[model samples]
Target: MSGLETEKELAEEFVLAAFEKDDRRTIRRMLTSDALVYTPNVPGPGLDVDEFESQILDAFHGAFPDLSIAVESLVSEGATVVCRFTMTGTHEGVFRGIEPSGETVLVTGVVELRLTGSGIADVWQTTDSLALLEQIAAYDHENVRGERGS
Candidate 1:
């Protein structure tokens, strides 16, 4: 395999390990200790490896105990790998202060990862938060109708 192919394979393995298997140990091993993580869900500065594990990984596991990520595609060039994925799960625990609705949600997202010899060094992630919220009935439709005098 060429260098780029190898990096793509590694990126695939990392995603499977992190989301499919939910193997925190392997995920940790695949990331640099000080890896930078950015996601639309989190505010302020980007997260480090530890914060990513806790805030992103742990929180997702809690909210969606049976969460699964299906990779739609993965493309790589140089040190950067971009993965487009669809995530499916049921809301069984609190997520972002929203109470559990026992609703199944399908969310699509893309993640760009920058890799180094030491492992993954940086990550930028974007997901369809509005879709997730709609799935879980987070919006107050009746209130909106009332405000509009409908």
Candidate 2:
């Protein structure tokens, strides 16, 4: 396959391994040593490869052990691949200082990956965090109302 095609395929595999399969080794292999990733929810400049693995990969995988990400579409130009995906998982473990809510959340997001000869050079991601936070807040409110009634 062509280089663009290869990059697209690698992006898919990276998503699968990191989000679905929780295969850290494969994820490490896919990212370059100096890879940078930016996410909408994160503060500061961005995350390096190690921070991405620890904060994003490890944290999400731990919080949502049954997490699944389905790639809805992918397109590529030059060394960049853009992927649109849907992520679904149950909030069974503490995440972002929130207790386990046991609520299932499904969110859609897009990720753009820049690949180099070594591996992934950079990534930019935008996820539907507003929708996710709304759901979680609703769940909490419902529980609070129920507790007050009882």
By lDDT, the best candidate is 1
The deviation in Å at residue 61 for candidate 2 is 1.6
TM-score for predicted model 1 compared with the true structure: 0.88
Model 1 spans with C-alpha error above 4 angstroms: 140-150
Q: How accurate is candidate 1 locally (lDDT)?
A: 0.86
In candidate 2, which residue pairs clash?
Answer: none
- What shift in Å separates residue 150 of candidate 2 from its native position after superposition? 35
Clashing pairs in 1: none
Error of 2 at 6 (Å): 1.9
TM-score, structure 2 vs. true: 0.85
Give the alpha carbon lDDT tens digit for every residue of 83-133 in model 2.
999999998887777677888989888889898889988989777876666
Candidate 1 structure quality by residue, lDDT tens digits, 121-143: 99897789878888887587668
